[model samples]
Target: MTPFMFVTDLDHTLVGDDAALTQLNQILTQHRHEYGTKIVYATGRSPVLYKELQIEKNLIAPDALVVSVGTEIYLDGKNTADSSWAEILSTGWHREQVLSITEQFSELELQPDSEQRPFKVSFFLKQEVAASVIPQIELMLEKYKLNVKLIYSSGVDLDIVPRSSDKGQAMQFLRQKWKFAAERTVVCGDSGNDIALFAVGNERGIIVGNARQELLEWHNQYPANHRYLAQNFCAGGILEGLKYFGFIK
Candidate 1:
C-alpha cells in the first residue's frame, strides 16, 4: 500500500456542474500548499481536451495525464509515450475482432483504417465470433488466450490494447518519471475501466456513489472505502471525497 496520494476521476469524481471542487477539490490545493500533499486526476480525455480545460480552468493543468485511453502519454505538456505501445497496437491478432465489434457495438463504422479516427488503433480483435459477449467476454478471451488488454470507459465504450495499455501502466510510467512511489498513489473514478486501475493500485481507489452496483457491492477494499456523497453527482462527489479524506479543512 502506498503512503497516500489522493487521485480522482475528473468528469464526476472530482468536479461538479457548478464547476466547484467538492471535498476532493477543497483539499487538493490546500494539501499541496499546507501539507505538501499532491492530488491528480486520471481521465480518458486527450491532450486536446486538456488544453481546452486549461483555458476554462476546469483543470489546474494536470501534474501529468493518463489520457486518450492509453494510446498516447503526455508529460509536462509533451508527448512521452513508449514507442513499443504505438507500434504493437498498429498490428496484432485482435485487430479484425475489434473492427467487427466496433461495427456492431460502437457508433463509428468499423474500418480497416483506424488511423483516421480520433483514437489510435491499438489492435484489432476478432469480434465477429458471437459467443455471447454479454455473458462471458472474459471467458471467451481466456479460452482463446488472447494477447490483448480490454478496457471500458466512462460510457459503454470498449478499448482494445496489446495487454499492456491500462491506467495502472500509465500511472506506473508517471510514477517512475516523476520519482513518486507507486504505492503512494491513489485513484478515484466511477467506471468499469477504472476497476483495473483500482485492482492494481488496490485500497487506493476512491469509488464515487455513482459507481456501478457490482463495484459498489464488492468494493470492500477500504471500508466506507467509497464515500457516499450527498450530491450523488460529479462535483458533489469530488467535494465529498476531499472532505472524507480530510483533504479540506
Candidate 2:
C-alpha cells in the first residue's frame, strides 16, 4: 500500500466518548507500515487543548497538527508554520458580535472580548446551556455579520468557524505543505461543520449516516461528500469510513 496521509477533526473524528483514543488509532497503527498512513489533526481546538490531551494521553498524537481553526499549524508537535488573519478577526463584526453575545448571556466565563491573534476560543458547550443561549447568539449574529458560520454538534457545544476556517481548508494546506498530491488525501467526518471539507476533492469523502441534514445536502450537490457510512459516531463512523475508502480491508 502506498503512504497516504489523513488530516482529521479531533473532537469528533478521532476522539470518542470517555476521551478514548478512537479504536481507529489502533487500526491506523496496523496500516502504518502497509499503507504508510500518517494522521494530522486539523481541529478548531487550541494548542492548549492539544497539550492537555497529551498530558492525559487521550488523543492519538499526530504527525502534524492544524490547531486553532487553521490559524496555527505544527509539525512533529513543534511549530513549523503559521498564518494569522487576526486583522480579519479583529475588525470583523463576527468576532465582536460573538464577544458581545457571550459576554452578555453566555453562562461560560470564557475569554470573549479578546481581539487578538490566538483568540483561544471555546468550541462547544453543554447541551442544556447551549439551548438557552444559541438563539440569542443567532439573533445577534444575524444582525451583525453573515460571513461567519456556526456549527452545532451533539455535545450542544458550538463551533464558530469562519465559513472560511474550515477543517477542509486546514487539510488542504497540510496536503500541499507535505507535498502530497490531492488524490492521496482522505477526509472523514460527521456534522454540518464538516460540510466545507467535502468541497475539496483531493480524496474520498466519508460521512456517517448520523450526520446533519445540511451536511447531507452538500454531499448531494457535490457527489463528493457523497461517501456515506452506517456507523453511528466517533470510532464507529471513522472505522466505517476507513473501510469504505479501502484504507483498511
Candidate 3:
C-alpha cells in the first residue's frame, strides 16, 4: 500500500471537539505506525502559539508544520526550522516595509508581536471594514512596489505574506520534496485562508460542514468533484471525508 500525506489546519478545523480530535489522532497514529502515512499541521499560529495548542489540546505532533500562514515550515520538531523554505520566502519579502505601510492604516489593529513573523505581518480588522481597508492596503503596497499576498480568515484575522508563500504553495513544496503523489495528498480546512489549500494541486480536500462563509462561497464558485464537503464538523468531518475518499473504511 502506498503511503499518503494528510495536511490539515489546526484551529476550528481540527481542534474544535476534543473527543473527535482524540479519535482522529488515534486513527492517524495507527495509520502512521502501520503504513508510514505522513501528517502535517498547517495554521496561522506562530510556533509559540502552536506549541501552546499542542499542549492544551494534546494533539499529536505532525511530521511537518506549516505555520505563520505558510510563511514558515518546521520539521523533526517545533524547534527545527526548514531553512530552505525560509530561503524561498526571503526573496521579495520586505517585512519592515510592509509593516511601515500597514501601520499607517489605523483601521488595521496590529496583532501581538509574536503573531508578526519575518515573512508575515498579521492584523485584526473587522469584517465590515475589511472590504474597504484591504483594497486600500493593497493599493498602498502596490504604490510601494511590494509583492505580497493578503489572507483574511475567520472574518477578522488578516495576514500579509510574501507573494510566493501561502498554505497551497507550502503544501506544493512539501509534496515535491517528499515525492508524494498529488492525488494521494489530503488537505482539510474550514476558513477563507484554507481556500488556497484546495487551489494548489490535485490534493483531495475536506471542507468541514461548519466552514465559514468565505470558504463556502469559494467552494460554490469552483466546484470540484475531488473535494469533499463533509457533513460532520471538525475532526469528525475529517473522518467523514477520509472515508469518502477511500482512505479508510
Candidate 4:
C-alpha cells in the first residue's frame, strides 16, 4: 500500500458497522505504522462526544481530530486546542450574535452546550421544516451581516460556523501544512456536511452507498472521475473505495 492521508467522517460514514469498522481500524493502524499514513477524523461531534464514541467503538487514534463541525482541532491526542485554527476562524465569527439571531426561531432547538464551540453554534431543525427555516435564518444572518455558514446534516443537525471553517477547509489546512500530495489523499463521507470534503480538492473521494439524499444529489450534479460512489455502506464502503482508488489491494 502507498502512503496516503486517510480522512473520514465518523457516525454513518465510518462507524455504522462494527465489524467493518474494526477491520478498517486494523488496516489503517497498520498502514500508519508501516507507511507513515496520516489518519484524520472530521466530525460534528464534540471532543467529549468523540471520546465517548472512541471508548465504545475502539476507534483508531487519529493523527489529528477535527471536531465540532470543524470549528476545533486537536493534534496527536493533545489536551491543548489548536489556537492557530481558532485565530483563523475568529476573523469573521460572532458566536453570541449567531446565538442571538438564531434564538428568535422557535423551530430551532439549541444543541447541547458541549456540542457548541466558540466558532460553532449548533441546533436541531427537523428535516421537514429545515427547508423553510434555513432560508429564514440565512436572511436574518445576511441582514445582520454575519459571516457564518450554515451546515445541516443527518436530517437533524444544523451547525453554524465561520464562513471559512468546515471539515474540508480544516482538511485542506492539514494537507497543506503537512505537504501531503493531493493524489495521495483520500476522503470518505456520506452526507451533505461531507460534500465540501469532495468539493475542494483533487483528493480521491468515496461516497458510501447508504448516503443521504443531499449528498447523492450533489454527486449526481457534479460527477468526478476522482471520486467513487461505493456499493457498500459505512466502513465497508470505505474499504471498497480504498480498493477502487488503489490505496490498498
Candidate 5:
C-alpha cells in the first residue's frame, strides 16, 4: 500500500470555528490511527508560537512541523533543524542588512522580534503601499545581491527567507526523508505563501473556499487536475479536499 501524507497550513486554512476544528481534529485523529497517514503542519509560526496556537486553538499535534515558512523542520515532537537547509541559508543572508534596507521604506514596519528566525525576516506592509513598494524592495535585494526570497501574503504580511527555503521545498525534504511517494501526498493551504506548495504539481494541492484572491488567480494561471478548489471553509474544506482526492471516503 502507498504511504499517505497530509500537509496543511495552520492559520486561516486549518484553524476555523470551534465546530470545524473539533470535526477536523476528530477526522485527523481517526485517519492517523486507522490508516497511519502522516500529518504535518506547514506554517510561518515558530515552534513556540505553534505550541501556543495548539493550546489556544485546540489544534491537534502532528507527526511533524515545517515551521518558519519552511526554514526549520521538527519531527516526532522533537525540534530538529534541517542542516542542509541551514547551510543553504547561511551564505549570502544578513538579517540586519535586510532589516536595514527594508527600514528605508516608510511603509514597511518590522514585525515583532518573536517572529524573526535565523533564516527568515518578517514585516508588515500596509495594503495601500504594498503595490508601489514591493518592487523597490525587490530591487534593493537585487542590488545587495542577497540570497533571499520575498513572500507577500494576504496583501499585508511580507516575509523574506533564503531563496531555497519555502513551504514546497520543506514538504519535498520531508517527503523524501519519509520516503512517501508524491502521488500519495496532499497539501492544503489558503494564501500566497502556499503558492510554492501548489507549484509542486506532482503532489495534490487543495485551495480552500476562503482562499485569498491572489491564490485563486495563481491557481487559475496553471490549471491542473491535481489541484482542487474546495467549496467549504477551513477544516470542512480540507475534509472536502481529502474526499475529492479519494484520500477519505
Candidate 6:
C-alpha cells in the first residue's frame, strides 16, 4: 500500500495548544503505526528551534522536516541541505543587504536572530505599521531586484524568504522525493504563512478554525474541492481533515 503523507505546520496548527497537541499526538501515533502514514513538518522554524519546541512540549518528531520556510530540509534526525533549492535561491539573496534595506523602516522590528536563516529574514510589525510598510518594502525589493517573497501573518509576523522556498514548495519536494501520490498527501496549517502550503493545487488541505483572517480570505477567493475548513482548532482540525479526506475512519 502507498503510504499517505501528512505534512503540517507546527505553531497555531498542530502543537499550538496543549490540549490539542496531546490529542494530535495520540491520534498520529496510533494511526501512524496502523496505517503506514508518513509525517512531515513544514515550518518556518529553524531546525534548532524546532527541536527545542519538541523537547519543551514533549511532541513527537516528524519523519522529515522542511525548516526555515523551505530553505532547509532534514530527514529523520539528520540535517541535510536541499542543494537544488539553495542554488535557485542564491541568485539575488544578500541577507545583509535585505536587512539593511528593511532597517530603515522603524515600523518593522527585527525578529530574534535565531529566526534568521540564510534564505529567510523575519520581522514583527503591528497591523497598522504593516499596512503602510509592506507596500514600501515590496517596492524596495522590486527596485533592488531581490528575488525574495514576503509573507505576512497573524497581523504581526512578517517573513521574507526566497521566492522559490515556501511550505508548499518544500512539501511538494518532499512528497515527490518520497514517491507519495498527490491525492494521498494532506497539509494542515493555520496562518497566512501557511497559505502557500494550501495553495499547492492537487493536494488536500485543512485550514483550522483559528486561522488568520488573511488565510481565510485567500481560501475563500480560490476554493478547491479538496480543501476542508474545520470548525475545530489545531490538531482537532487536523483530525477533521484527515477524516474528511478518508485517511481515517
Q: What is the C-alpha RMSD of each candidate to the true structure, in Å?
A: 5.7, 5.0, 0.9, 1.0, 1.6, 1.9
Encode model 6's per-residue lDDT on 80-151: one tens digit a residue: 676776787788788888998998888888888898888889998999778878999999988999888898
How do the predictions measure up, each by TM-score?
Answer: 0.66, 0.67, 0.98, 0.97, 0.94, 0.92
lDDT of 3 by residue, 54-148 (tens): 99999897999999999999986858679999999888888889989998999999899999888889999999999989999999999998989
Flag the better candidate by TM-score, 5 or 6.
5
- lDDT for each of the candidates? 0.54, 0.62, 0.92, 0.92, 0.87, 0.85
lDDT of candidate 4 over 84-176, digit per residue (tens): 998999996788889899989999998888988778888999999999999999999999899898999989999999999999999999998
lDDT of 1: 0.54
Question: How well is each residue in 1-249 modelled by candidate 5, as lDDT tens digits?
Answer: 334899999998998756877987887788888878899999988778998999999777788888989888878877677677678668777888998898888888888888888888898988888888999999999999998889999888899998988999989988988888888999999999999998965899889999999999999988998899999998889989988888887
Backbone clash total for model 1 is: 21
Supply candidate 6's per-residue lDDT for 105. Answer: 89
TM-score, model 4 to reference:
0.97
Which candidate model has the greater TM-score, 2 or 4? 4
Local error of candidate 2 at 229, Å? 2.5
For every model in order, what is the number of clashing pairs? 21, 2, 0, 0, 0, 0
lDDT of 1 by residue, 157-228 (tens): 556655766666666565655565654556677766666556664434556767765455456544444343
RMSD of 2: 5.0
lDDT of 2 by residue, 29-134 (tens): 7676566677887765567676776566556668778776555667776654554333334334355556565666546545333213243345446777777677
